[model samples]
Target chain A: MEVKNTKAYEVVIDSIKDMVFKRELKKGDKLPTERELAENLKVSRTSVREAIRALEIIGLVESKQGAGNYIKDDFATSLFEPLSVMFMLQESSPKDIFQLREVLELECCRLAAKNIKDYEMDRLLAIISEMKETDSEERSSILDKEFHNLITTTSRNKLIINVLNVVSKLIEISIKEYRSQIIDLFKNDRKLVEIHESIYLALRSRDEEKIIKAMEKHYTLIKQSVKM
Target chain B: MEVKNTKAYEVVIDSIKDMVFKRELKKGDKLPTERELAENLKVSRTSVREAIRALEIIGLVESKQGAGNYIKDDFATSLFEPLSVMFMLQESSPKDIFQLREVLELECCRLAAKNIKDYEMDRLLAIISEMKETDSEERSSILDKEFHNLITTTSRNKLIINVLNVVSKLIEISIKEYRSQIIDLFKNDRKLVEIHESIYLALRSRDEEKIIKAMEKHYTLIKQSVKM
Candidate 1:
């Protein structure tokens, strides 16, 4: 059953949520103590306490040893924390997550082509070059992450970045289990570098169609190389 | 600094996450008591309590004041709880969220076209017909949700469904703020019905290209109509 809207604790959560939206509170801002919140909202202290606990669990708030609860500063990480737990629950499949990654990364390329700052473009090219020189699978994978991350950053869409961060983490867990099988495939970094270059050239050209084609080819290659 | 990985509280979250993955714990299963968890994991009782609190916030675990904590059954909602909060924080623009919804729905249409069950197709057609008959803004909006929801469900991708659920909630909030302005545009339910029919027919055709084109036009119309 859907249980999001009815609980008293939810009322408190909603209040804080509205506060965040209205900018009465922000990242790292302190929330009033349970007793204070209870008095202000005309709810029992216990309910207020429960609401704070729920928010803390979700990473929207944190309770320090001596301090009261405060809004989390690293909201993006917190935003995906519950999602990470849900992954553990096997609520979603690896293939489903990978498909999402492909969609988001493709969009990221299209957006980056339009809005990528020159510095971000330079960073993307630099990471591609670094991947060419790196022989270690470990280093190559790190560059791979950086390359994709640059694209996400260039998208200038925080929501997309946050969504992708969650999807990428899920992908990482699934990929780790099959790393041994893909190690040989990944050893040929030249093809990988070339794919990224195609992406880079498209972004440099600032052509959305080319970006989409290049990214489609990039993910298709990765999809074929990795056996889920 | 990003402290998601380094905190003591995170250890507790990780342990519970591992349990869920290993199937030592299941949905609706009760977790060990806080004291018991602290002793077994060799952490302080307070740490265990904090962990439980955080998990509860994420909807992974629910606290039943008198009965202790049980794993929640609806984990997908939990997965997006923090993300909902992030939306309130305005980390994303309406355009970004709408862009995301477009990408996901396009994939949803493609997959749904390929995998939609006969019953699901019938349900989708029913919703479109219902939209055609309904002129009330409220009823049309509800049918609009059902139409999109059916597409996501028909996609048979739990991960995509979860991601879109979060995005949909964000869109709902933005739409509510501008409901009056768009109510006139939305009063033209015939156009809405026609767009959905296009999607429904494409899904029936089981042609991925037609589905993509139809879904793209559907969202492009929406993107133009919604100022946000």
Candidate 2:
């Protein structure tokens, strides 16, 4: 029966999932060849291949003409196909997306403060310094993205980082609208630089409360300033 | 240049996105034929079709071999592709996914409390009553889905509903695992039924705090009972 066959596939998928969760298999780790997997699981090669193909479509594995299938590390590309369509259908506004971003980025900031490595802190400081040197709004925007990307990376939660990355890309197409609305919020680039400095200090101190407060202040100010 | 052409296609996509967002066209609504769109937008049919094709991949529209493209009501199919891929790549645990579900469904419960219609409440109650009569685990699971679906519909936020629907599907596949845990924890169907009743009462009262509290209680119990 159709149901029985579906159940068989589900069992196959679950076994693979368990291995990944147990870390017996890891991200970017190559899975066994089809024949090997079938033999190990006592399933038909057809079932094993089907499960692998399904996982590939979902962005778990990449199969090339010659190269074996390799596990993917990043989650954003996997999310893009569905999220792009959802955003298109929902026609989510910049404001609505912004609200979601605020909730997520604030959490990221708090987590990064607690968990960011010294090297990451150095990189973040360098990015901020680079942003300070850039006079062009265009260059600054790119630097801004890098800054946020670093913060998200340090959050150490794949789901959060993936969702934030998708949201960032979706909003990138509308950056002009966002910029036009908030162009005058800062008196000069120095004020923006100063805010980043304060945030950096809070992060360096590993002060969770301070980090949350700083992030809230930064976002609230930006939101208010943009309204002008 | 390639850049210029991509920009033009983006413009076409944006215009259609605006129409959909503004509710000028809804799910199941037919779009103007490709030729009509080309004439109206002053773009080539090729450009229009390209944009539509991109949207189709994301699940906004469905084009039949003979029938024109129809707007899609549910975002499930569109969202599933990318999310499933992300799940596989991240190899997310049920706990991680459950955390997301908890946040999302709790939000849905709160929103439904404020917005659910009398008919919708009646439908939800009907499902619960039917679930009580059903001896089959499969039927009970179906009724459980309907209960959550009703709440999502009443939330009146398409974006939330779309995200929740995708999560719901993933959860459905794992419900047996979740149920066994809950059964182990509570050991009484009556207690489980009471939790749902309390949630339903919170909705009827339209008390946001009560809804949130009820959801927290329900999820906390679920978290304790379920094997993540």
Residue A101 in model 1: lDDT:
83
Candidate 1 clash figure, as a count: 2
Error (Å) of candidate 1 at residue A5 is: 12
Q: Score the docking of each candidate (DockQ).
A: 0.57, 0.15
DockQ of 1: 0.57
Model 1's TM-score against the true structure:
0.87
Q: Which stretches of candidate 1 lie over 4 Å from their true place?
A: A1-11, A21-24, A28-30, A43-47, A62-69, A73-79, A176-180, B1-10, B21-30, B63-69, B76-79, B176-187
lDDT of each: 0.77, 0.68
Write the residue-wise lDDT of candidate 2 on A178-218 in tens digits.
64445565545666666777788889988988887878777
For candidate 2, the TM-score is 0.65
Model 2 Cα shift for residue B213 (angstroms): 3.4
True contacts kept of each: 0.68, 0.14
